[model samples]
Target: MRSTSLLVLVGSGLLLLAGCAPATGDASAGTGEAAAAAALAEGEASAAAPSPEPTAGDAEQWCADADVSARVDAALASDTEGPHNGVLVSPEEMAELGEPEAAIADQRRAWEALTDDEVAFQQCLRVRQGQSPVDPVPGSGS
Candidate 1:
């Protein structure tokens, strides 16, 4: 009876091992499909190139067209905060307000995506508009 039990256990283990073995098949069977899928993905990625960065000239034009400085002055005179174009709530404040953590993360990511020149141009415009520049900048100190 003991030998029978041992034989059963060994046979079961062998069966399990066989079941876990890799199947015998042509490795290249799906290679064409995978290559085609990869090519399609690459094409899609290449076609989705990002828009060009906004130049400082573009920022200046936007500020001028929007009359941001005058609007900011009016907002300040009325002791009201204007709709800050690029500003968002701090993560701590967002948490206190019961906002989703993802919101904070998304805002931070967007800010971090800005180039240094873009940040400088934006700060320049903000200062002109009587709003405080995002001091220390995002993804940097403070």
Candidate 2:
């Protein structure tokens, strides 16, 4: 999907360039053959180019990135403002349920575990919004 979107973006740019190409006084004066040859050369160059190799740690990261994105999507789908649905609470009620420090601490740890993937996914979202894609969040490994 990401690749498809990028292709569309690039295709759009190419179309804009084609539209902006200068029109010769006599466009058919060898221009057509020259353009055809140029396109052929470009196609041959593209065909001969070597494909990119994934980095060393990419094998391990592939699954982690997908899993973290799935988890985050699920969490967001079920997002809520917590059980305390915005009602005034008395000082006594507040004191009754101190701060749930342990729960907060555990949640923080869980978030930390996924922070890098989360940042990378956020950049993916930015690209889907028509912004430039960014580098994946820096991980300890790479």
Candidate 3:
């Protein structure tokens, strides 16, 4: 789903460039093709690139972020019973919780994991990769 969104976004951008391309055939000939090709190349490069390996510093920084630490602690303290435990809820479960299915699926794709250990590992790597915010769902207070 996210890949589709990205493709749509890239396609729209290419269309915009094509539409906005100067029709005069000025000094920069084939500018639209060039732009589209460059965009495609960039997208390919990004798609082909592997996820960066996480470092110890990345873990330390994630642990040290006060907001992140507080949020994690609060979530841990609040959730005591679910299989997901405020952290690794299934995308379907998230959809059931009022999040749109497609959006949740996109988020899950970005999440990139299913099991608890993988989720934890991905969370740390994601922090290193993008500093993506930790998502701590509020528990049902059971």
Candidate 4:
């Protein structure tokens, strides 16, 4: 009776393993079809939607507006006058300067009020010097 029970358990284990075995051609084909269908659906949705076009104003806005440039300049100048003279400003400083116009003045004032690391200070100055102010808008696109 014990031997019969052990045999039955082994047989059940074998059955389970066989059921978990890799599927052959037809199963693989079905999986591939499902994946293809998903891909097609995604493609169709993407195709149905039109991407927005970037305006010239958007381009100009991204290229460091006047407020950003001014703040960058101010931070760099503050760094120069402080104990951190000859230091380089970090990308964080640049980002702070590049913040929205409404926040720039306060940000610049805060930066000026505190002493920054020498490296961060110098870097900010260098970036400010390198940056060219935006050109005046043309009367029209000519």
Question: Which candidate ranks first by TM-score, i.e. highest?
Answer: 1
* Candidate 4, 35-60: lDDT as tens digits: 53334333422443332343444434
User: How well is each residue in 35-106 modelled by candidate 2, as lDDT tens digits?
Assistant: 533443344234433223344344334324676446434433442321111111112221232324553344
The digit string of per-residue lDDT tens for model 3 on 34-76 reads: 4544453345334433324545666675546555555444433
User: 101 in model 2: Cα distance from truth in Å?
Assistant: 52
Clashing residue pairs found in predicted model 1: none
Candidate 3 lDDT score relative to the true structure:
0.35
For residues 15-109, could you state the per-residue lDDT of candidate 1 as single tens digits?
00001111232111112223533343333224433323445654464355344545433433442222332223233323343435775576556
Candidate 4 lDDT at 99 equals: 29
lDDT of 4 at 69: 43
Ranking of models by TM-score:
1, 3, 2, 4
lDDT of 1: 0.35
Candidate 2 Cα RMSD (Å):
23.2
Runs of candidate 4 exceeding 4 Å displacement: 1-63, 79-126, 131-142
Clashes of each: 0, 0, 0, 10
Task: State the lDDT at 69 in candidate 2.
Answer: 48
Model-by-model lDDT, in order? Answer: 0.35, 0.29, 0.35, 0.28
- For residue 119, give model 3's deviation from the true position in Å: 0.9
For model 3, give the 10-residue run with minimal summed lDDT.
1-10
